[model samples]
Target: MTMPDINYDILRRVAETASAYRYKDIWITVGPEDGQLVIRVHDAKPTCEDCAIFPIAKVDYGSSPSVEVATIGSESNPVDLLNLEVPAGQMIPAGTYAADAVFWSQSAVEKFMIPYYASVYGDQADVVVQTLLTVLKPAAQDGSEPDPAFAIAHLPGSEYVTLANEGLPHLFLIRQSGRVEGAAKR
Candidate 1:
């Protein structure tokens, strides 16, 4: 199958826009069109912690970084970010407790987000990456899948994704009650 023609500069521009304006709840996805890549970024109003945020891509397992850039875009409504509320409280006793969780894995973030953030933030890119990592899961020294903290520090912006969209979009509908859509499965 052939791909679409993508305007890569657009992706870079969008990333620059996010950084300049400090948009929050940013959701980015990449697709192919006419032999090119079509990138989508769900833009949303900055969160309360708007002052700080997150990145895109700089990925590799055992390969050199590619020069390919994608065309980034947005739907009618973009995305909103969710942050962890560091509650002021006493320390809790350490004990084993089973729990459930759902999050974009650390490797996922690195493969998808790090490059984007690194594009703008340079060496300090991991700061926001770490932020999103916390919400998605836990931090790790090796920078692979995070150690599950059994909590979601961040989540999709429910406002733009569900309510504002006016219906069940494929993006959000893919996950229902912990069962990912068949297409999402390997």
Candidate 2:
């Protein structure tokens, strides 16, 4: 059976709304994995510059908020992001997946915020926070779930965020002893 296609129109609407509201950066990608539909949004980048310098920042830069979303659409058996799970020992299947990532600088606020107006003009701070949240909500919606084909592993800090799409489960193999290994063969 064919998986239900993601509604790009809805995605476009969300993107436009996010952009109109000054979300700044927005993207949408669609693909299939493990015989299931995959829809993902790479809405925002890491907040810290020290973190963003490296490709594998999650490992290199310690911990930061890395937000992503995935969804599987099927009429009879639709699956939400939260419900999906990575298999116990498997790797994410290879496929042509699309990703739209928005990378914005925090320094913009620093540059724009002059010392004199810092107290009175809090609107800038509010807009930045709101835009980030707005752009992230759709991705954080129930539709996005990690593909079960991959594994799920936690990072160093108490708040490490890794999406199944990035091969987290296989990348960081958590042993029974609670120590994490760098690689796990799929």
Candidate 3:
């Protein structure tokens, strides 16, 4: 099947709503013409000269029976900006998928997340937490699962905020398979 047409206005709204709850510098966007989704983190350069932003996406497929986290962009750009983009065919299959992502700085993860996970996993925390920062390919096309070694955390209520919001910039995605969908943020 072909990739579906995306509604980017909804993605902006989702980012705006999530921006209120947490980080304001982060924004989520989708390229309708290219059929790609992007999560961008901006304005870190002035605050921290050595800071880098990471967008970690956790995707949950409802029509199908699987949940997966596919990291598409992980390159460390200069401390200013970073964005994670998922091409439609590679990351999202034909089924309906609900995706939510968090934009965390490298320093934040090093200072907070890694240490916290380290307490639980011991020496493996550094390696274990890398799962959240690693670059991952999409699940195999032959119905095989993505790598089981890494587990990415799901950002709760993010997808709901994107879909349930009744205001303008509502998501109105129409898939080729006749399903309607929306993007998410957290």
Could you give the C-alpha RMSD of every candidate to the true structure, in order shown?
19.6, 19.5, 19.0
lDDT scores for all predictions? Answer: 0.32, 0.30, 0.33
Lowest summed lDDT window (length 10), candidate 3 = 77-86
Question: Lowest summed-lDDT stretch of 10 residues in model 1?
Answer: 90-99
| lDDT top scorer | 3
The C-alpha TM-scores of every prediction are 0.23, 0.18, 0.21
Alpha-carbon runs more than 4 Å astray in model 3: 1-101, 130-186
Higher-ranked by lDDT: 2 or 3? 3
Q: What is the lDDT of candidate 2?
A: 0.30
Q: What is the C-alpha lDDT profile of model 3 across 1-186, one tens digit per residue? A: 232344444444344445433522343333222233332233232232222233323333333334444442224421111122223432222233343433334454456555654554455446546643441223456856532211222232233223222211212222222223332211
Decide which is better by TM-score, 1 or 3: 1
Q: Can you tell me which runs of candidate 2 are displaced by over 4 Å?
A: 1-4, 7-22, 43-186
Give the lDDT of residue 139 in candidate 2: 30
Q: With candidate 3 superimposed using the best TM-score fit, by how many Å does residue 107's alpha carbon deviate from the native?
A: 1.3
lDDT at position 127, candidate 3 = 54
